[model samples]
Target chain A: MLHSVALKTLHDQRRSLVGWVVAVVLLVLMYAAIWPSIRDQPSMSDFLDQMPEAFRSLFATAGADMSTPVGYIQIELMSFMGPTLLILYAVGQGSSAVAGEEDRHTLDLLLGSPVSRARVVLEKAGAMVLGTLGLAVATGAALVLVGRLFDLSLPAGRTAAAMLHLALLGLVFGALALAVGAATGSPGRSRGVAAAVAVLAYLVNGLGGLVDWLRPFQRLSPFYQYAAHDPLRAGVSWPAVVVAVLTVAVLVAAAVWGFGRRDVRG
Target chain B: MSSAPVERDDAIRAEAVIETHGLSKSFGHAVALRDLDLTLARGEVFGYLGPNGAGKTTTLRLLMGLLRPTRGSARVCGYDVWHESTSVRRHVGFLPGEPALYPTLTGLQHVDYLSHLRGADPYPRALVLAERLDLDLDTPSRDLSKGNRQKLAVVLALMPQTRVLVLDEPTSGLDPLAQQELHTLMREHVDGGGTVLLSSHVLGEVQRVADRVGLLRKGRLVAVDRLDALRARSLHHVHATFDAPVPVAAFAGIDGVRELSVVDHTLTCAAPEASLDRIVKALGQFPLRDLTCTEAELEETFLAYYGRGEDDAA
Candidate 1:
């Protein structure tokens, strides 16, 4: 706890991280338990096909081949639930990094020392990145390990690639929240803005296939950089990774700039 | 032995460790601090006295770089306050008005974190301060009493042992004994060549430790004087009961006489220590049957400059 800012931040979130890891494991376990029955029924694929085109596109990024492990995992985990959990976790951590400290009035204690404002923001961003990536890796490992019990042998390399994209996706939103919180010094406002932007970005990605006008802008959403290339089926997209990483870098820089130029609230 | 006088002369002529040149701050239309010009030498405690919302906190924040100044500039240990705030903060140990700690962190953890940020070892001096303040270092901040939390904050601010300490209402929540200990610590810090600028609403608290005092009223520094000089200028109550009635005009004409009242055979008035001789000579003109003179407390001295109006500030 007395170490550098990044280490201290991770230390502070240790208990919450454990809880999140447990939740991710349980969620994967539930999906694994249901997979065998769905694979044997064959009618589950028909049910997915019968759904409205918009609903079908919203839920499934790849083709709705529920019989195969990769397609099922893509439809069930990659498109929505996985991103939602990771993004929520990232956004929460980022928003709380600066504004939450100020809200608790402990910022004076930390800032009173010789630590520069920019360093605090940058180190907190480093913590968010590490935590988000660690959670993504856990989610991926859980998916592959639990899927084995249900005869769903997903490729380890493809799963790692997908998790990589997912982690970067989470980082984008996390950095946005961090920037907002640093600029405004209000945790609630920061969370609200980040959530709103995420919802808008999510809608653009989910409805992009059905809505013609939303098609071009879909590529602009962080979700597009995450799942549009179908990292689960076609492992790793360098362009998407570069874009997401660049987005996170710019946002973190903005956070530092925003925090540096303003009066910190007590 | 002869070098002692040379060092004393140099100390007298030493550049002020804390200097603010016409520093000012305002939030929109509301002025928090205006045209503050102050200087503090090493080995001195300068008490900042003001009611709430008189820009005491704002001034401290500006000095800390938490809030940038709107006009002019300030320097702590020769570093610019706004542009070079990190440097200024390197030398200044600040205790905020309401010192909030991490609720889950224990006192020792808080000290460790702060000292580590300053890149100093944690235990030696912190343990000493904790023992002196009677604080339980193992207790989490949320569990600590208000005074205990204050004690922990005090330890953090003083542990670094920086060149300057800017404390905002440092003794607000302390018990009398702890307050005394804090005052003693401030004196010791100043004696060790550290400058202190402490703010307080209670004149008695400042009077105990400050060599010089600055009074703030409505965003302006109205008075700055040596504590001894201020005390010398402090008003004294003079009450005389003569056998014959004294003329109201006799004492009314005296310098520094305020609130003068001469009714019937009794004359009661407040006059500065300097005006005591003239007031007494006026009383001597008539045979005085009874005479009583007592020095008023500095609280009254503060009130004389600042009326009893809380609504005017804050």
Candidate 2:
């Protein structure tokens, strides 16, 4: 089964994956724990309201209330830190899927077996998806645990929806990285291209609301689809979720096609 | 002896386990393989001999369907390599010149993963191979020495019990004992009616184990002959110390003799196997004190072929 490759890859990544999950969970819990202190200070909400619109928009908290649990978590965790960690994790795994095998000179041995090139690409992509989903679940669980301990009254459905969006967002970058890796057979190049896209998209989405000129290009970034509806408060937007899913599908198809046609150079 | 005709027919027929028809591969403008034709019969060990950059690895890649040929075609176990690669792979086992393994996986895990990929249970055979090769399966592949890594690769390729084995420099990093064990394993494999395409630059190893050898030079096959036939055709250095002065002319103009010379009471000549009787007859004319005839090594024979142009090779 193609899933066998995914299982094997996941097993190989088990140790490092635990570390990433632990770090993400700890980061989430640490941020969630501090929300109560900030929520108790009425002066803090006044200070946030007095802040310049441009400065607030830069952090994606312009229209949202800073004192509320959903608004605070969106600004401090979900909007930037959580999604960034998940995207980086997915991109790392996706880029390593094909290009890493070539870089390590292990692709030849793997392909020498009876497995098809398409299966290899698809299976590795499957592994990346699994890892990204695992990260999302870990982060979501941490958020829930800390929210309950701190009495933040976080809505369970909205939190799950937020995690679902985050996972989809990670899938977009992961699939892109996989596609680039398949075409180039170079992990460094794949990572560079994916990271460049991620950083540029992030900046365009974050700054688009603050600057009038960048607003037109904001929708072109995947971060717009992820953050536009604010899934942590409004629950999942089906259109944005569909877009993310379709983008991942297209990129994964490209990866499998490119990998099937190219020579196993390494 | 009674199966010779049947085996010959099997080799010529479509039943040849591994066959290539004018297979060629080019990397952009540089040709790696050109108009190469090869055939291998079941239960035979065919050595593919060449120097570096002689397309030995390229040919193996083409047969494995890792590289598509620019022209013609190749088949393993009667399946076209490029078109039906999965089927081809199902019947053939391959070991590359350098075996690269997953670093984090222990030797046992690597075996398990590969076997899982192939949809076969290899543990039993793997255990036997580990014992034979003296491999430690618990060690991480990253910690294994080069020789151990090679042993792991060998076990992976052989454990599947595939019909054909394509091994490129299979003994490159093996210790002497391990190398001997590999040769024994290959012999045993062939004895079980398996075919092997063994590619290497080591002439002595090929000469020791291969029933037939194909000498490749500059991406072209220079010669493909049985070991005995190649030995017969190869030049042998003959040195004789005579009791009396023997005319060098007596050894000249003989079939398969070349570079005849006489210095003092010593006579020296190069002769092929066909001229042995005639040379002995000529040497009998003089009272000889000592004589020695050394057959040219396979390396020297291949070197001679390597020095020849394509036209000469053809």
| Highest DockQ model number | 1
Q: Per-residue lDDT of A154-255 in model 2, one digit per residue for the tens?
A: 788889998999999999999999999998898998989999999999888878987889999988889988878878878899999999999999999999
Any runs in candidate 1 off by more than 4 Å, and if so which? Answer: B1-14, B302-314
What are the iRMS values of all candidates? 0.9, 2.2
User: Tell me, what's the RMSD of every candidate?
Assistant: 4.3, 4.9
Global local distance difference test of model 2: 0.84
**Cα deviation in Å at residue A188, candidate 1?**
0.3
User: What level of docking quality does candidate 2 show?
Assistant: medium
lDDT of each: 0.87, 0.84
Per-model TM values vs. the true structure? 0.95, 0.91
Give residue B170's lDDT in candidate 2 (0 to 100). 97
User: Model 1 over residues B1-314: C-alpha lDDT tens digits?
Assistant: 01111123333434798889999999888988999999988899999998898888998998999997889899888778888887678788999999998888898888777776766657478899999999899999999999999999999898877879999999989999999999999999998888999999888999999999988888888778889988888989888899988789878889999889889999888888999988888888999999999889886776675545734554
Across B20-110, the per-residue lDDT of candidate 2 in tens digits comes to 9999989999888889999999899999998898999999999988887899998887778998887688777899888799887788887
lDDT tens digits by residue: candidate 1, A133-219: 999999999999988987888999999999999999988999999999999999999899999999999899889877999999989
